[model samples]
Target: MTMLTIDNLVKTYAGEASRRAKSRSGTDRTAVANAAPARVFAVNDVSLEVGDGEMFTLLGPSGCGKTTTLRSVAGLERPDSGRIAVGERILFDGDGSRTTNVPANQRGLGMVFQSYAIWPHMTVFDNVAFPLQVRKRSARPGKREIQERVAKVLETMELGHLADRQATKLSGGQQQRLALARAIVIEPPLMLLDEPLSNLDAKLRESLRYELKRLQRELGITSIYVTHDQIEALALSTTIAVMKEGNVLQTGRPREVYERPNCRFVAEFIGTSNFLRGTVASREGDLVDVDTDAGRIRLESPVRVPVGEEVIAAVRPECFEISRTGWGNRPNEWSGTVTNRAFLGDAVDHIVRVGQGSIRVRGNPAISIEPGTEVHLATDPAKVTLVPVG
Candidate 1:
């Protein structure tokens, strides 16, 4: 079932010139008089459908409007024109003539922001219980019910023992968990997480990433997650929408998006991709043969392009098989000198100087090869991706 629907969402802002003018003159009227600023489209014609119990991620770089789009759905920012509905209940409908905008609190959606907005003065238990206590008189749960709910949520978050501790006294990870506990306490139809784990250290962030996935699965809560971290998105999302400059470039399952990026931006942004520019030499069904500077490369791709047309063959580092000896007669094999190598604990990254250009190859950490050593890299045709030239 579709839990949330965002259609034709557009949110605009006065360009930075307006803000600069305001800073210089100290007045909004004066700023407007100084210059007619162009409108900046924070979110332009963005639309998405989130299914029940799925983690839908809006992945992109900074200033790409992922946050703005998430904020619009949260009612933190009213969109210029769009319709947002949650399970048939309209949260926002802004189409010039008629507007139906619900207050953020009234939307009843769980939100865990970048900041762990826990009340400092409140105890750990109180922090989670506050949401339930503030409900309207008729809707409010009984004192005992609130305690049970809060206790259950806190226990789920592994903070049950610290229920009496001051919110400020907890560690960073615990506080983040507390915030999540508070959000899910209400059992909302949809959850909005805006880089909630960004503040934590790298190690902690990784630990919580799986923790969050587990919680979402156990709770069966449909969530819209916003983040710039590609690996995090790939690890946690059921579906990922790659956004750029207020536009969504592609949306698909993690594997589908990672394996078959629709465009160059997506191929580059999702992860490190070694792009080989070429003209399509031939095509038979889904298999494409591209002649590039690196050499002739064969790949299986769903994207159809005429022979002799320009295309880019995007190959991921991990897709290549690195070996000391040559794999004779392989379909996509290239012999190169190891220009650089880095130990990544679990894997080793080798920058091999292949043909006119270098391509990175990730392989087993146990098979370490020193720089300047000759190596052979081979990949299956199915592993290479044919990205269309834009």
Candidate 2:
């Protein structure tokens, strides 16, 4: 079931007064006799649908419009044009002659921002119960109900024992939980999280990541998260939308996006890959043969290209199997010298230089190869991915 829908969402900002007006395309057009200032599109024609009970993440670098899209859905920023809906209720629709926009306070969405935003003067219990206490007179819950709801939410967040403590007196992680507890008390239809872990230390952030996922599944609340951290998105999201420069480049399940990226940017952004620029040498069903400076490599890819078409073959470091002896006549086998090596505690990485390009291979620490040693690398065809060149 669809929980949230956004269509043709576009947001733009006007520059400072009276400098020469820039065009919408960002081209330095010659100033007309009298023209309006140029408009910069923060989010350009973005559309996406998020399913119920799925943790959807909008992932991209800064200035890529992930936050703008999230804010628009939260009714925090009014878009220049777009429609935002949850389940059948239209929170924002700018399509018709009469536009409909619901205010943020009325949207009833639970949101956790980068900052905890805890009320220092209030106790943890009061912070979570405040939402219930401030509802319209007829909608407000009774004292007993409010107290019970707050207590339940605090316990779920593992902060029940600190309920009487001042909100600011808790640790950073606890404050984050307090913010989440407050949001959960309302039982919102959808939750919007914007880099909610960015402010915490690495250890706390990682610990909270698993905790948040467990809590979400327990509550079964649909959530839309925005973040630039690729690992965080991969670890926590069920679906991911990769965005770039105000446009969504691709959307898919976390594994699909990571293993089979649609474009070069997606492959480069989602994770590290050894990109071997080559041309399609041959094709037989899903198995493709590419000729590169390193060698003629074979890959199992869903994308089919014409013979002699320019392409880039990408493979993850962990996908390659490295050994001291050559695998006799393997489909994707190449011999190279290990020019560099690194010990990463649990895994070892070796930089092997073949003809002109180098491929990084990572594996269990037991397979570490010495520098200057001749090593043979081979990968499963199914693990090699093909990327179309721009």
Candidate 3:
């Protein structure tokens, strides 16, 4: 079953024009001359469908409207246009004919903000029980029921020992866990997390990401996560929607998005890639011959390009092989000078200069290539992708 559906959503803010105008000014010109435009498209014509028990992620850079789209679904921000449906309920419809606009509290959605949002004065138990206590007096659970429910959720979140401790006294990771407990205590059908781990340190964030995904799977809760971190999105989500300037450029499984990107923007945003600009010289079944400044090469491409049309080809850093011998007998190979080398713990990154552009290649440091050394690099033609450049 599709748990949530967001269709043609749009959000425009009045403060964007002012920010853009300020960005275009020179350092010496301190005085502002004119008022900026009044409209900014925070989320523009975005649509998505999330399946039940699936972890969906809105992944992008900052100011890409990932958070805004999440907020609109939470009913915290009303869309200027679009329809939002959760299960069989219509939450927001812009046509005015549908009178249903469920308030956030009544929407049965759990939210975990980046700041944790736990009360410092309350114990973990109280924080988790607060949601149940806020409902109408008649609907409130009895004391015994509340205690059992609170304990159950705390145990599930692995915060049972900290249940008696004040939220303020817990560690950053514990506090984040407490926040999750609080949000899930209500048993909402959908959970919305907005950069929930951004406040934590890098190591802690990395550890908690796995824990969070495990917990979500155990509970079988449909969740929508928003983050600017590509790694987090890739590691945690069943599907990721890549956004740019209020538009959703692509949405697919992590491997699909990474291996078969729809455009240059998506290919560059999701991870590191070496882009080669070229023109299509010829075409065969799944392969296309690309002519670049450095040399002519044949690459496997699912995307078609007419002969003589300009295109950009992208290959991931880890996909290339660095060897002392030239592509003696291989079809797709390039020779270039090693411009820079960085020794990453697991793999060394090499910047190979080809013609006027540099392509990053990742390999073991044991290969023995030094900066300024001429080297030959080869990549499987089947792995190369030709993307249309706009």
Candidate 4:
């Protein structure tokens, strides 16, 4: 079932004009008065659907409009145009003839923001039960029911033991979980998590990240998560929408987006990649052959690039096999001198210079080679990815 649908959701902000702009040559008093300020389309023609019980993530760097899109869905930011619906409930419809919009509170969504918004004066138990206590009398649960619900939610969040403790007394990670506990107690149809783990330390973030995933799985809640961290998105998302400059560039499974990016932006953004300028040599079924300055390489790709077309061959450092001896008669085998080496505890990174190009190869720690040593590099055809040129 489609739990959430957003169609042509657009949000824009007018650019702030400078006070000195009125004195500029082209902008006289009349020109300044009549001029229409520039508009920044924060979310431009954004449309997507989230399946029931799916953890869909909106991923992008800062200022990419991901947060804006999430806020629009939460009814916190009113979009300039478009329609947003959760299941059959029309939360927002910006059509001129007929207008329909449900306020944020009436939408009944569970939201955990970046900040841990726990009440300082309240105890953990009261914090979780407040949402229920504040409900309208007819809709509110009885005192006994609220206590049972809050207790279960606290235990699920692993904060039950600290229920009587003041909210300010808990640690950072605990406070964050308390915020989530409060949200989950409501049992809302959808959950909106905006960088919930961003403020924690690295280790705590990783631990809470897996815990969040486990809770989401156990509860089976449909969620829309927004984050800029690549690893976090890959670790937790069922689907990821890569956004840039107020538009969604691509959406796919974690491994699909990482291993086979359709464009250069996706390839470079998802992970580190060595881009080799090349031209298509030939096409055979699902395979494509390209000739680069380093050597001839083959890639397994569904994207069709005509022969003789200029393209880029992208490969991850770990995908390349680095050896001291040459593997004769194999395609994509190149000999180069190791320019530098870095020993990362579990893996070793080697930078090799081959025909005016530097190819980075990462391998097991046992394969570390010193600078100035000769090395041979080879990779499987399926490992190479063909990315479209600008």
Candidates 1 and 3 compared: the better one by TM-score is: 1
Better of 3 and 4 by lDDT: 4
Candidate 4: C-alpha lDDT: 0.91
lDDT of each: 0.93, 0.92, 0.89, 0.91
Query: Between candidates 2 and 3, which one is better according to lDDT?
Result: 2
Model 1 per-residue lDDT tens digits across residues 200-292: 999999999999999999999999999999999999999999999999999999999999898999999998899999999999999889998
Taking all chains together, each candidate's TM-score versus the true structure is: 0.95, 0.95, 0.92, 0.95
lDDT of 4 by residue, 56-127 (tens): 999999989999999988989999899999999999999768777789889999999999888999999999
212-324: candidate 3 lDDT, tens digit per residue: 99998999999999999999999999999999999999999999999888899999888888788899999988889898876776888767668999988888998889876
List ranges where model 3 is wrong by over 4 Å.
15-37
Better of 1 and 4 by TM-score: 4
TM-score of 2: 0.95
lDDT of candidate 2 at residue 337, scale 0 to 100? 98
Clashes of each: 0, 0, 0, 0
TM-score of 3: 0.92
